[model samples]
Target: MASVKPWSLVLVVFCIMSLSYFVNGAGSNEGLGASFIFGDSLVDAGNNNYLQTLSRANIPPNGIDFKASGGQPTGRYTNGRTIGDIVGEELGVPSYAVPYLAPNSTGKAILYGVNYASGGGGIMNATGRIFVNRLGLDIQIDYFNNTRKQFDKLLGPSKAKDYISKRSIFSITIGANDFLNNYLLPVLSVGARISESPDAFIDDMINHLRNQLTRLYQLDARKFVIGNVGPIGCIPYQKTLNQLNENECVDLANKLAMQYNRRLKELLSELNGKLQGAIVVHANVYDLVMELITNYTKYGFTTASKACCGNGGQFAGIIPCGPTSSLCKDREKHVFWDPYHPSEAANVIIARQLLSGSTKYISPVNLKQLRNL
Candidate 1:
C-alpha cells in the first residue's frame, strides 16, 4: 500500500473508532444478563406476597398507578415500580427478577435471575419479628444458594458459573427495617438488646451485612451495587411517629442512620479492596432523598413531608396505605407513596441517579459503569 499522510491516517482511525462506538451502542440491548436482588421491602418486588406476613402491599391503592399491572399491586410496596424494578428496566434487563417464592421462579425461569428480598426482611434475624413471618438475610441467602444450584443444572456448571460471575448485577437495599422496625420501634424494640445504643446496634448490622455480602461473592456474583439506608428520619412515618415539626425529621433517627452510613461506606471500601474480582458500588441515598424532602419543588414534587396514600396523622402516615386510606389527588407530586416507601415517580428519579451519577451519588462507580465493567 502507498504511504498515507499522517492526518489522513489519524482521520481513518477516528472513523473506525466512531463506527465501533455506534455498533456497540446499537447492540446495547444485550444489557446485563441478569439481576439478582437482595434486601428488604425497598427492593422486594413481590417475594413477601407468598409469605404469611403482615408487611404486605398486594392490595389496592398500593398499585393504583402501576400501569404495567393494569393499576393493580404486583406486591411492590409503592404506587408503581420499586427501585429494583426501575433499575432493571433502565439497565435494559429483559425482565424483573422473579420473586424467589413465586411458582415461576424455577428451572428455566431462573436463567434470568431471582429476587430474594422480603417486605419485612433485615440484616438480622430478629429485625422484623413483629411481622410474625419474614425472611432474614440468612434465609434470603439460603434461597440464593439454592438458585445457584439450579443455575448450575440449567446451563451446566461452566456456563452457569460464567453467566453469573460475569453477566449479572447483584443489587441490595437493606438496613432500613433494621432501624425502623427493630431499633426504633416505640415499643417492643428488639434493638433494646443492644441497650438502644447506636454503636452496638450498628456494629451488629455491619458484621451481619459483611457476611451476607461475602456469601453472594462466594456464589459467583461479581458485580454488586448496594444502597445505603436513606434518610429514615425524614420518612412520613418517622416524622409522624416522633411528632416533630411538619418541616422537621426525627433527629435521633437521622443521627443513627448517618452513623451507620459512615461505617457502611468504610465497610464497602474495605470489601472492594479485599474481595477478589468483585465490584461493590455504594448507592448514596441519604443525600438524594434529603434533597427531595428539603427542596421538593425542585424535583417537581409538591410535598416530600407527606405521603400520597395513607391514613391519619399530620402526614397521613399513621397507617399504611389500604383500601380505606385517603390518597392524594396527584401521586406524582409526593415523594412518599405511603408512610415508608417512595412513589414510582420518586423511585425513577433515585434509580436514574444511582445508575448514572458520579462518585458523589454512588461511590467507587455507578451502576452503568459497574454493568460495563
Candidate 2:
C-alpha cells in the first residue's frame, strides 16, 4: 500500500490514457440510462443553495467559468463545472442532474437522475456540525429513497427497479469534510481528537460509508464509482491554514487521507464480492490530484498551490470565494477556484481519466465499461 510518487503517477496516468481501451458506446439514453450523484460539495450541483446552511456556494465568482449557466453561479463550489458535471457530459447524460431538493426535481425529472449531494456534508452526520444544517450521507440517501418512490409512480415498479439496477451509474465523491471540518477542527476537534484516536474516527467514517453504500445497493444501485479521498494536505486551504511554503503540503492531512483511502478500497472490494450483480469501481483521486498539484506547469496550470479566488492570505486560502473575493482573469491557469474546490479545467482532466483511463486510475472497470455493460 505504498504511495505512488508524483512523477510516477503522472507517467502512469499518461500511459493509461494512451491505451486503446474500448467500450460499446451507443446513443445518449440508449447506453447509459441515468446517473445518480452523491457525496459532498465536490459533486453538489446546487442543493445547498435551497438550504438555510452557511455551507453554500450560491455566490458570485463560484461558477464564473460555467458557460452553461450563462456565467452565473449555480451553487457549485468551484469556478466552473465539477467532476460530476464533466463525467455526466462524457456519459451522454442530456442535462446536469437536478438537485434533489429543487422544485424541478420531480415527476419525469427523476428519469434522467438526481443529485443528492450537499455542501459541508459527510459520511457521518456529525462531520460538519459547524455548518449547522447540511445533509449527511444518511439523509441524502433518504432523499434518494423518496425519489425512488416517485420513480415507481412515474415508470411503474418493475421498470423503475430494472432501470435503477441495470442502466444507471451511481457516482459518489466525498469524505474530505470529515477530516477538514470535524476531526481536524482547531477549536472543536481538540476534545474529540484527544478522546478518540485518528484510527477510531476513520473507523466511524468507514462504517457509516459502508452502510450508506449498502443502502444505495438495497435501493438497486448496481454500477458504482466511489471516489476515494484526495490529497487534502496539498489543497490551498490546508497549506495556508498551516502556514506552509508554496512547495509544502500539510503532512498530517495527507497521512489521514491515505489511511482512509486504504481502508475504503478494501471495503469497496468486499462490497463488490458480497453484493450480487454489483460492479464497484474505486476511483483513485489521490494520485491524480497529487500529480496536478506537483506538476501544474506540465498540465498548463500556472499555480496549483494557490486559490484563484479569495483574499487576505499568502495563498488566498484564509477566506472562501464570494462576491467580494479577488478573482483570477485566467482561471484555466489555476488548479483551484477556491481554497477547497478544483477549477473546471482541472475537473476535466480528472473526469477524463475516470471515464477512460486504466485500472490504475479507476479499478476493475472504468466508467465507459460500466456504462456500456
Candidate 3:
C-alpha cells in the first residue's frame, strides 16, 4: 500500500467535511418536499420556450447570470432564477423543477415536480390573448391534471395519491398579466374598462381563481402557497409608460393590484377553512414588493425603479429586454431585471423572506413551515 501525503489527507478531510455540511445543512430536514410551481412570467421557469408567443425571454441577456444553463437563456423572464427557483433551492430541492412542456418532463423527472408556469399567463383564459399562444391559468391547471394522471400511472393510484397529498407543495404566483395585458391594454382595454367597472373585473378574477384552486384541491393537492399580484404600478414598464417620477407609481395600476390582492387574501382564507386537510397560505407579494421598492437602499439595491436589462428613456421600461437592450454593468445592484420582473438578487431577498419571514409577509405559515407540514 502507498502512504498518503499529509497535504492529501488534509484535503480529503476538508472535502468530507464540506460534503457533510451540505447534506446536513438548512435543507436537510426530512420534510423537505417536492415543489410544483404555477404562475406567470414572474415565476415562469421556461414554459414559454415551447410556445410561439412574442412574450418570450429565450434570448441573449435574459438568463445571462443563470449558472444552470452556463449563462444561456432558459426562457426565464429575469436575469437569473425566479423567486420560485430560489425558494425551491433554499428548501433543498435537488434539482430545478423541469418545465412541464420540456421534452424531458417525463418518467422519473415528474417525481420531483413540474413547472406549469407561463409568461404572460393570467387567472383568466382570455388574459394573455395578445401573446397568441400563452397558457393561461386554466390551461396550466389542465396540464397539471394530465400530470396527475401520469403520477397515478407511475406510482400506482393509491401511492400517488398519498405522495401528492403528503409530499408535495404547490405554489401559484399569478394574476398580474390580467391587469397589465387585459384590463389595462391601451387600445384593447378601452373597451374592457368602459364595459366593466374595476369592481366587476376584480370579481371575475376572484371567481375564476376560486374555481382554479378548488380544482387543484380536487386533484389531491393539499399544500398551497398562493402569491398575490405585486405592485405592477412600480415596475419599470408602468413607470416608463406613465412617465412618473422615481417614487411615484401608476396610481390606477396600484389601486387595481391592491383591490385584487384584498380579494385574493379573502379567497385563500376561505379555501383554508373550507378545504379539508388543506393548507392554503397567502403570500403578501404586494406589500413585500412595495417595501422593497420604497426602501431599496435598506435591501442593498441601488435602483429599484429601473430595469437592469431594457431600452428607452428614464427607467428603461418602454422596450422589453432583448438582444439590443441596454444591459446594466452591475446586475445585482438593480431590483428589476426587465420591465416586468425582479432580478435574481431581488428574487433572493424575496425568496428568503417567503421561506422563513414572519407572518406579516406570509400569512399563517411561511414556506419553510408549509414544507414541513
Candidate 2, pairs of clashing residues: none
Against the true structure, what is each candidate's TM-score? Answer: 0.91, 0.92, 0.92
Candidate 2 per-residue lDDT over residues 1-373, each given as its tens digit? 9988999989988666544111111223454667899999999999999988999898897888898998898999998898998888888787888999898998666677899999999998898899888998899999999988987887668878888888899999889999998999889999998999999999998999889999999999999999999999998888998899999999999999999999999999999999999999999999999989998999999999889998767899989999888888989999998999899999999999999999989989999888988
List the RMSD of every prediction in angstroms. Answer: 8.0, 12.6, 5.5
Model 2 stretches astray by more than 4 angstroms: 1-29
| lDDT scores in order | 0.86, 0.89, 0.90
Clashes per prediction? 0, 0, 0
Off by over 4 Å in 3: 1-31
Report the C-alpha lDDT of model 3 over 1-373, residue by residue, as the tens digit.
9999999999999898866533332133465556899989998889999988988999999999999999999999999999988988888778888999999999767777899999999998889889898989999999999999988887778878877888789999999999999999989889889999999999999999999999999999999999989999999999998899999999999999999998998899999899999999889989899999999999899999999999887999999999999999999999999999999999999999999999989979999888888
lDDT of 1 at 121: 91
Task: Output candidate 3 Cα RMSD.
Answer: 5.5
Better of 1 and 2 by lDDT: 2
For model 1, what is the C-alpha lDDT against the true structure? 0.86
Residue 183 CA displacement from its true place in model 3, Å: 0.4
Ranking by lDDT: 3, 2, 1
